[model samples]
Target: MPTILTFGDSNTHGTQPMRSRSSDLPRHARRWPVILGEELGWDVVEEGLPGRTFAFPDAEMGPHMDGRIGLFIALESHGPIDALTLMLGTNDLKAQFGASPGEIAQAAGFHLDVALSDEMQDRHGGFEPFLILPPKPFAAGCLAEIYEGAAEKAQAVQDAIRAQADARDVAVFDANSVVSVSDIDGVHLDTSSHETLGRAVAEFIVAEIVEA
Candidate 1:
């Protein structure tokens, strides 16, 4: 069976909506990756951490600094990965962490390309990357201080990814095109939004992966 891996934070983790407790189990059924896997009949691995990022001010944010270290470790432990879906950047835009959305997006994009390239060479022997650019947060006044120019930042990063995909002859899905920012929390994806994302990703893979 083909395998797909999702790498990201809380939203990607599918945290129980409006939960107050820390030990709440994720609603995996509501997460896009799980839905996509079901729709496509693929093995899905959910590696979405709650407080993870590509960059952080703290030295000990997680096992990976750029998010790729842990990714490498995960791949080594799990064997081979056929596809990778990354949905991050929300936490990296927090002002408390002193990371701007532009910087976060750019740096993350770069590292993502690097990781995909390495994974392709090492695992698949060479596979085009499949990327997903998540939409801007839906909440107002939440990231205003940190991601002051987030919309623009997102666009810039999306454009760069598109260009990179073009160069690498890969595929990409812009979540902003499918899920509206007005529909959910500035950061979280509601059930409806998750459904949309799942459908979109499933469609993309069905259309692109065979030849890719």
Candidate 2:
């Protein structure tokens, strides 16, 4: 079976939407990466971290949140995967970052730059770098205060991502077309959304990348 890597933040990490940080975690069977693997019959390597940012060093989460460095580490560690996925920027929406929508997309551009570079291509022996644009976050739950004024910015990111995909020539999938963030906390996926998103991503990859 071919290997595919899912790289991103909490949603990709299978964070179950909730009001507060708790011990509860989504089961592997429900996580999108697992679902994608099952649907595609491929080896899925998940490189997801909560609070991860596209290129920013998080305040509470510290510098480890920088995806540029994390992605390089993941790519080097996993090597020779058949393909890879990028889903990020939502964390950058945190009020702490004080980043604008365009800035967030610009960070994503930087990340794509690395992914599409000679080093990463050589590391993976060449594979499609797919971008998964997340749904607009609703700041109406426990994270409301943390994501204040984030809703509008989140919406803008979708367009920015699509534009970036066209400019970069990377295949892109809009998560909003399949699943929105759970209303419970407004930043993470519900169980059903996770399942739905997993299937959607599987179909998208097959049609857009594999069979294209």
* Clash total of candidate 2: 0
Q: TM-score, each model?
A: 0.77, 0.94
Candidate No. with top lDDT: 2
lDDT of each residue in 23-129, candidate 1, tens digit only: 45556577888888889898988888766666663354554545656566655666366777776666665545565445665665664566566654587555344
**Residue 120: error of model 1 in Å?**
5.2
Task: Give me the runs in candidate 1 sitting further than 4 Å from their true place.
Answer: 16-28, 57-66, 97-102, 118-120, 124-128, 138-152, 181-184
Q: Write the per-residue lDDT of candidate 2 for residues 1-212, one digit (tens) a residue.
A: 78999999999988778767564755445799999999999999999898898878977778999998999899889869989999998888888888877887888888788889998898788888899998778787778888888887877876886787789999988898989887888888887888999999999999986466
Which RMSD does model 2 reach against the true structure? 1.5
Clashing pairs in 2: none
User: Candidate 2 at residue 139, lDDT?
Assistant: 84
lDDT (Cα, 0-100) at 94 in candidate 1: 50
Clashes (N, CA, C under 3 Å) per candidate: 3, 0
